[model samples]
Target: MQFEPGDRRRVLPRHLRPAPAPEVFAYAIRPARPADLPHVREIYNHFVSNSAVTLDERRSTIPSWREKYALLDRLGLPFLVAVSPSGAVLGYAVAQPWAGKNAYRYTVEDSIYLGPGAGGKGLGSALLQALIEACEQRGIREMVAVISDRGAEASIRLHEKLGFVEAGRMGRVGHKFGRDLGTVYLRRALRPSRPRRGALFGRSR
Candidate 1:
């Protein structure tokens, strides 16, 4: 996918556009690079340490995340970051296979995280919207979000704003920070499956 000037605006509909902020216009969304691992790890580790947003119990190391980046590259998946004009990593988003089975090939699970002081400015929405477009371009038929039930209203609202619907909820399936946490599942269909062509007049192509 191409990343051009003001492409973020083009990718997001007007209603979904984050309200203008001091850094909003100064930031651009683009694919993640190797150098971004430190900042990415920082943002992710924040959630791991401070919140149940992610079920990960340990902080992610640079080397470990580097392997993750490599796997995403190997699988041709979308791993994007939102960067400021000064090149600070504001936030990031990624899409991974929802399941490893061949039957789940057309589906993907999305994860998004923003750095401290980056919330409520629409950066999260922008990053997620861009990720959705990238996944759709790659022919992904469905997108899913697995969100923690504890104080994740913003994340849930973001997914709903982007057209995802609540598919299911798992009650107290996760244990984090000495408390049981439930998970909310949201799903959005990217596109309808193409109808398979039947053999014409009993002749296979």
Candidate 2:
């Protein structure tokens, strides 16, 4: 008797089972909420304590993250996260004022980090792109990313792929893990999400 298409007993051989499709990585990108701070801190502090990707030697705490969350909200800057279906924060990216001065109001610096096993799965790119779009919508002009020179080549390439241009580099700016580390600065000019309704210096005729 021919096996019916719905037959479950006919276990296909390992090679013959119409090769099971690759499992898809699933996550959603969205603005970070206050509750996500703990997870965000965990992701960043991992790099801080175990790697040279971040220059900070101090581990990030939930309190500090809360303060940051509040500051970003007050400034209307974007702090985004990628969360798994179960609501776990998988990664995060945030933009802060490039400098405290009023002259720097239109520019911002970005920080991004992924939780363990979250990299190489397109999460970094997705988070960065979403952050860029959010900034553009808020009328921000420029974005800067200062990435570590050690063990961060992937981050640099990801930024470049998203239209960031190398602005500059500084060698030996930081010493961590018994070695001097440097940073590569990349900059991207952001366009408004939508054009102004009127022509420059004049209204449409």
Q: Write the residue-wise lDDT of candidate 1 on 1-205 in tens digits.
A: 6888876744678989898865224477888899999999999999999998899999999999899899888977789988877899988999998888979988999999999988887777788888877787777889999999997889999999999999999999999999999999999999633333221111011
Pairs with steric clashes in candidate 2:
none
TM-score of each: 0.81, 0.87
Candidate 1 runs further than 4 Å off = 1-25, 192-205
Model 2 over residues 40-156: C-alpha lDDT tens digits?
888888898998889999997888889999999899888888888778888888999997899999999999999998888778888888888888888999999998999999989
Candidate lDDT scores, in order, read 0.85, 0.85
> What ranges in model 2 sit over 4 Å off?
1-13, 194-205
TM-score of 1: 0.81
